[model samples]
Each structure stands twice: as structure tokens, then as C-alpha cells.
Target chain A: MPEYTFLVVEDSPTMRQLISFALKRIPGSTIVEAGDGIDALKKLSNQKFDVILTDINMPLMDGLKLVSMVRNDPTYKDIPVIVITTEGADDARERGISLGANAYVSKPIQTQDLLNTVNEIIKSKA
Target chain B: MAKDSDSLSKKVENFLKVFKKGEEFTQELLQENEKLRYRLAQQEEVSKSSGRGEALNEQALEERLKTLEDENKSLLDRYHQVEEENKDFANRYIEVETENNNLANLYVASYQLHSTLDFNESLKIVLEIVMNLIGAEEFSIMMLDEKTNELSIVAQEGMGQDARKSIKMGSGIIGQVAKTGDAFYRDGDPTNLKGIDYTHPLVTIPLKIKEHVIGIIVIYKLLIQKTEFSNVDYELFSMLAGHAATALFSSKLYSQSERKLTTIQSFLDLLKEK
Candidate 1:
């Protein structure tokens, strides 16, 4: 099995830690943490990642804009993207999907569901 | 037989030592493989069974979600109710504190009014009560002579030079309250001073002891901070009307009797000496 690197973008330190912890359960999983979209973009420019997990609401640039940026770009466009947000509205989920998000997970997050979704997206891409 | 047993033991120890090398690694790999196979089989069974159980699981989750939402709403309502109760308690506490302070001020003012037999000192106390307790900066205390049927200013403070030193019964706002023995408060209504220059008198309280109106206290204006008078101020005015009058009258009679006793003592001594 190939070593999978995941980029976790969330403003809250606790949520970032939770995502990293869950991802660590999978063998050979590597995680990079970013506070917001701008930091995530900088990290993306520096390294290659197999998957990106992001939150919708952030300080400088939101996850929607990040998703759009990733989808528009040529080099990193193929990277699997998953959106985790407090916004559970249909329109918000639809917007994330239209912007090329592979999956949408609402907050009050179900940890098992999130892990399974991550696994599924990664396997599908593989 | 003992030699055979020792040889078997040595064989077992040697076998254990061999097992500690690369054989341990192979055992661990086999155990891990068994665990993986078990997990994979469990996953396959779950996937097959989930086709039938998915709807039931979804229904249970929906019910749980609804219960949580209702609980959250009820907790939110309880929080708002507690906040309202706290606000009401705070308002009630402020009202109770104000009433207590007002009663204390009244007691202190009553005590000051009758603390001394000196008429001048009693009068000074009344002035202090008006300025400090009542928040009035400008006012006048006047005495009504029964024989002449005239009112004269006994103690005055913060008054304009143009203010009249005396007013007849039934002449203006002050005289009307004095004539009828009724307390009058016309705050912000300056049209009632009748024929007198606008000195902006706020209220006129008739000082009465038993049915006789002894004098009147005219409040001209409050201090800068006090914009208007409250019901509590009105209650204070009524209290002063009764208590202040009795204090002044008693102090005056007491001093007069003391002077008369002194004179009698002097006359009696002179006669006894002769």
C-alpha cells in the first residue's frame, strides 16, 4: 500500500487535532494541518497531498473559495477534496458539490462516517 | 529415567531459544494476518447485512436527532427564562434598596430637626435636609404670623436678590398652599407663581402642626443632576410638612420656657438677698 498524505484545513485547533487523530488510525497515513484557506494554499504549493479535508467557514479565505481554486488549477485539480462545515443547509452542500468537493460532512461530526467517507473517496480515486 | 528427563528439558530450552529469533516474527505475521482476515470477513458480512438494515438504522438515527433537537430547544427556553428571572430580581433589589435608603434619610432628617433646643440650629438642620436629602439647591422657609396673617421668610438659601421676602395669604402658589394647608408640586410648570417674576418654584409644602399652618417650605429648583422629582420625593415632602413643623414648634417653646425659668430664678435670688 502506498503512503497516503492528507491536508487538514480548519481554523479551530481542536477540530484539526480530531481530524488528524482519526486519520492516524489508518496505517501509513500522513497529515498536514493548516489554520485557514491561505495557509492551506501555501502548504499545497510546497508539497503533494493525496487528499484535502477543509472547513467551510474560516477567517481569511473560506473552504468554498479554496475548493474552487483547487478545481480550477491544473496541477492540483485531481486531488480528492472533502468539505466539513457547520453549514448543513442544502444550498451550502450543493454549492460545495458543484465546486468539485468529493464529499460534504456537517458539523457535530460523526467520526466513523467521516473515516469511512475518507476511505471511500481515497479508494475511488485510487 | 532422570538423565532422560534432563535431556528432554534441555531440548525444550533450546527449542524456546530458537523460537525467540525469526520464528517470533513469523508468528506475529500469522497473528496479524488472522486479524486482517477476520476484519475483512466482518466487513463483508456487514456490507451484505447493511442492504436490509440501512433503512432501520436511518430511522433510528432520525428519531435520535429529533429528540436531541427538542432537548436543545427546551434547554434554550429554560436559559431564557432564568435570564428573565434574574433581571426581575435585579429590578426588585434596586427598588428595595432605594426605599430603604429613603426611609433612612427621613429618620436622620427627623433626628436632626429635634436634636437641639437652639432655634437657629434646628433651622440649619432643616436647610441641610433640604439641600442634601431632597436634592434641592434653592429654597426658602417662611413663617406665618397668626395675628398679622402674613408670611415672612425665616431661613433662605440660593435665592435670587429679586425674590420677595414676604407673601400674603392667597397671593400666589406659595400663599395658596399655605392658605389651604395643602401641599402643591408643579414641577416644570412655571405659570403658577401668579404675578411674581419667574423664579421657577418647583413645589410648595405647607408646614402644619395639628390643623394650624405654621409656615411653608418652597422648593425653587433641584440640583443639576436631578431632572425631575419622583413619587418618593413627594412622600418626603409630606413627611417634612408634619415632622419639620412639630420640631420647630417644640424647639421654640422649650427655649422660651428655659428663658422664663432663668428670669424667675434671678428675681427670687434678689429678693432673698435683700
Candidate 2:
């Protein structure tokens, strides 16, 4: 089995930790945490990631901007992007998809939902 | 003349005898021909009847084959239906498993809160529970001071330094929750992060020991992604109200007892020196 690397970007340490913890449930998954989009970009430059999970609202660079940048970049364009949005943030969710995110998971996220979405994206890409 | 007449009569008698014998032979040949024709007709009728019987048997076999094909198709349709039903059951099982995992998370949070007896550790656990479980962005843990009848901020996250340090009991929403021991939730949209007045929080849960309220967990803003509270969030809030209160109270008592023990030990040491 191939090992999967995931980049989790969020401003809140608590949320970042929770997301990383949930991602760890996947077999052979390696998670890298970033405080915001800037940190995520820095990491992206250093190493290749299989999937990117980002939150919409961040301090330095928001998730939507990161998604657009990733889509524009030749190196990261093929990587699957999953945006984390608030439950009622329909506009943000649509914007994230339009910006080239592979999928979106709503906040107050259910662990199962996050897992299912990631698994689906990973299977499709495989 | 007498001799010639006798000879002629004898010759005529012989000729009539030969003619009668030839007629008998011809009648016997005709009878034999008629019997052979009747037997051939009977054989042809029997052969045609057997051919008809074979055709009837083939028609019955073809009908049987069609019925069997229809039955096979129905069985295949049922097989697909069962396959679909099995998929639905699997999905339901996953949902139940997810619920079970959520309950496990709650149990672990509760266990961690009570595992520590240090006052600061207990406070830290409460902060983590609120941040990780409730997804609060800006919030504070306030302990009620009985003497002053006011709630003071013991710990906070994402709140500005100039945030209010205390609230008088029964004064505002947070205070009212502390006074009544009932949890307070904002009426309007909880996701709107605009016009954030620190005085009015989105949720205020009163931490209590039995009937007495000890402190309150006031949340001003939730994380950007946390638009609304979930059922599990409510369960955590309820659990925190009671479990956090007990943990803090027990740790506070333990800290006081440790101080008293130190004072007594110091007194004993002085007496021994004298």
C-alpha cells in the first residue's frame, strides 16, 4: 500500500490538532500541520503532499486564496484539496469548489464524514 | 356321315373345358392385387400419425424452456434487490459506529478532566474541552467569588486583554446564568461574528456542584467553521457543567489542604528546634 501525506491548515491550534488526529485514523497517513495558509505554502514548497485540508478563515492567508494559488501552480495543481467550511457557509463552499478544491467538509465536522470524503478523493485519484 | 359327327362333338367339348379353367385363374390374380393395395394404404396412415406426435412433443419442450428462462430472470432480479438492501444495512452500521465513536470521545474527555487533582491542571483540562470539543474561538472560564458575589476570569482563549475581567452576579446574561444555574444560548445566528460585544456571549453554561453554581463557561465567538452547535456539542456542554465543576472543586480543596499541611509541618519543625 502507498503511504498518504496530508497537509492540514487552520489558524486555531485546537482545530488543527483535532483535524490531524482524525486524519491519523487512516492507515499509513502522515499529517503535517500549519498555523495558516502561509505556513501551508511554505510546507508545500518543501515536500509533496497527497491531500490538502484547509479552513476558509485564517489570519495570514485564507483557505480560498491558498486553493487558488495551489490550482495555479503546476506542482500542486493535481493534489486533491478539501476545504473546511461552516455549516451555513454555502457561498464559501461554492467559492472553494469554484477555486478548484476537490471537495468540502462542513465544520463541527463529523469524524466519519471527514474520513469518507478523504477516502473518496484518495480512491478516485488512485 | 355317322363317324364325322361324333369327332366334331368331342372337339367342341374339349374347347369349352379349356375356357372355364382360364377364367378361374384371372379372378384369383385380381383378389391378390386388391389385398396388397389395402395393406400399403394402412402403413402410410400409421407413418403420418407418428410424425404428428413428434411435432406436438417439440412444441411442449419449447414452452417449458421459455418458462424456465422467465424463472431465471426473476431470480436474478431478486438477487440484485438483496444486494442493494445489504448496502443500505452497511451504511446504517457505519452511522451507528460513528455515534459510538462520538460517545467514546465524550467519555475520554470526562475521564481526563477528573484524572488530575491540581487546580491549574483542572483549569487546563476545562480549557481544552471547550476548545477541542465545543470549538470555541473566544471564550473564558470564570469562577464565582462568594465574598464579592462576582465572577472572575480564571482562564481565557482568543479574548482581548482588555476584555472584561469580572461580572457581578445576576447582572447580565453570563451573570444571570450563574445566578440561576441554567445554560444560556443566544437567540439569533451564532455564526455571525460581527458586532461582537464581549459582554454578551453566544453561549453561557453554568458550572455547578449539585444545587450550588461554582462558575460559568462563556463563549463569545466560535471558530470560523463552527456555524452551529451539534447534538454532541450539547452533550459535551452538559457533561462539562457537572464534571468540570467537580474537578475544579476537588482540586481547589486539595490545594488548600496541601497548604495547611505545609503550615502544620513548619510549626512542628520549629517546636522541635526549641
lDDT of 2 by residue, B1-274 (tens): 2233334445445544444444444445445445544654554566477666555655555565566556555655655565565556556555555565476557667877888899998998889778767778789999999999999999999898667899999998888999999999887767555747877789999999998999999988887777788778889999999999999999999999999999999999999999
- TM-score of model number 2: 0.58
TM-score of candidate 1 restricted to chain B? 0.75
Which candidate achieves the best TM-score against the true structure? Answer: 2
Worst 10 residues of 1 chain B by lDDT: B189-198
Candidate 1, B74: how far from true, in Å? 1.6
Which portions of model 2 show Cα errors greater than 4 Å?
A1-126, B1-62, B69-73
Q: List the residue pairs that clash in candidate 1.
A: none
lDDT of each: 0.75, 0.82
Top-lDDT candidate index: 2
Worst 10 residues of 2 chain B by lDDT: B1-10
Angstrom error at residue A75, model 2: 25
